[model samples]
Target: MNVAGARENVGSLVVHQSGIQCFNCKEFEHFAKECRKPKRVKDSAYHKEKMLLCKQAEQGVPLQAEQYDWLADTDEDIDEHELEAHYSYMGKIQEVPTADTCTNSEPLE
Candidate 1:
């Protein structure tokens, strides 16, 4: 209970949460650093440039179409779609052959 020495107790810092931390939500296994959601960095010009390039590509692509479709879908549905695509892409690495897991591989191939 000594207030004088409290600053010295670095080990007494309390951890309030654990588990995958969502970057967008900002809460533990997942940090904003590991977030799949697109994030803009305030101090980095390189990130701004990358974002501009991505924006340009989105303007040229069917990003609106996909976003509109996804907006109508549930969060779980969207996550399932993204996770499936992610896993399928990972499964296709040249160093390894995985069982045919993805139904839509044309665009990727």
Candidate 2:
């Protein structure tokens, strides 16, 4: 084996410094563990999976048999009041105002 050729071969090999990667934004430099960015809000698919899990559990399915718990894997800590406010806002946007909900008495002239 030629020693000079071996040195050239080793020099050609490029090495990259591996740092933390964020799963939320799929970016490097910052890790998902220490990520300060807003949590990726769960989409419809997430809710669908949760609903399926609930249905399965209600039917006496073995939840422990699963290798991973998708719901429990999240690192986000949801405040009870914040969750309630979110649901309350959603309710306000979704609820249709009926005659009972209307408190205005006099008609606009």
Candidate 3:
């Protein structure tokens, strides 16, 4: 082969080898064994992708909703404490811990 043709072939081989990605940092053109940069730590993006991926263990299992029709049962009576707790959690502020914590600065006449 001509010198120019041989050089071209060698150049192509280098280009092909450079396409390999580094296992350490995930960048192209170098292998992990030859990596000069610091080892990469998993970032939020990596965690996000991990969270988004469905695990094999949950795939075949059917999702159960035993309380899906909870509203259908109306015969159950809500106790006063339960009602009050639910109301408080739903954001109807009935009372404050102290007068100073209350938004009303004026004294009650």
Best by TM-score: 2
Candidate 1 weakest lDDT stretch, 10 residues: 65-74
lDDT of 1 at 31: 42
Q: CA RMSD for every model?
A: 16.1, 14.5, 21.1
Pick by lDDT: 1 or 3, better one:
3
In angstroms, how far off is 26's CA in candidate 2?
A: 16
Off by over 4 Å in 1: 1-11, 14-75, 78-80, 94-109
Q: Estimate each model's TM-score.
A: 0.20, 0.30, 0.26
Q: What digit string (tens of lDDT, one per residue) describes model 2 on residues 2-102?
A: 53332223377832314434544556644444568876565444444555666678887876422134435554787676556555544444444578976
Q: Clash totals for all models, in order?
A: 5, 0, 0
TM-score of 1: 0.20
Residue pairs in steric clash, candidate 1?
A: 19-28, 19-29, 20-29, 20-30, 21-30
Give the per-residue Cα lDDT of candidate 3 at 69.
22
lDDT of 3 by residue, 1-109 (tens): 3533322245446233344656457776555556798755444443332223323224543321211121122236757764555444445323444856777777643
Positional deviation of residue 28's Cα in model 3 after best superposition, in angstroms: 1.8
C-alpha RMSD of candidate 2: 14.5
* Selected candidate, larger TM-score, 1 vs 2: 2
